[model samples]
Target: MTGIRIELSRRERAILRAVAAGRGVLVSSCEPALTIDGCWCDHAAVHNLVEAGLIEKERQVPYGLATPAVITRAGEAALAEDPRST
Candidate 1:
């Protein structure tokens, strides 16, 4: 862990949980899209997670394609800290 604490909103936390469950992806296009189980999720929240280094794309794909989202070490740490995780 980087020892940096990241704060997440309820929505972001849910999104991260979904990603951690192998149900999230980022579709790269003119407007990037975040999806969970083939359904749309909060784009801004996904952006926030990515920016915070909590999650990332599993691999590079074509411009209009998508890749699986993987939780980072920081992401796991954040989930561990979730109040509901106790």
Candidate 2:
């Protein structure tokens, strides 16, 4: 396993943390997703996280929507290090 280090800006960090907290929240009758202000998170900001190696993306099951970004172990570490998160 690679030792990944992800650096996030203030807003990006918060958004990712929120998304992490909102994970597995049901988005539909058969799938799970997260929402922000009634906006289903396609998690485009995750591109930065991905470059930093903080998270990974995968295609949705059954429907094959855009790759949903998910927190990697490194991402959890980053979130934990953020004292502002709660």
Would you list the C-alpha lDDT of every candidate in the order shown? 0.85, 0.56
Among these predicted structures, which one has the highest lDDT? Answer: 1
Given candidate 1, what's the lDDT at residue 33?
75
- Candidate 1 lDDT score at position 51: 82
lDDT of 2: 0.56
Cα lDDT of model 1 by residue, 6-79, tens digit: 77888999889999999998887765578999999887887788888888889889898999988999999998
Give one digit per residue, the lDDT tens place, for model 2 in 1-86: 35444456776686677656544222322333445445665555644655566655443444434444567777788887767655
Worst 10 residues of 2 by lDDT: 24-33
Count of steric clashes across candidates, in order: 0, 0
For residue 59, give model 1's deviation from the true position in Å. 0.5
| TM-score, cand. 2 vs. native | 0.52
- Candidate no. 1 TM-score: 0.86
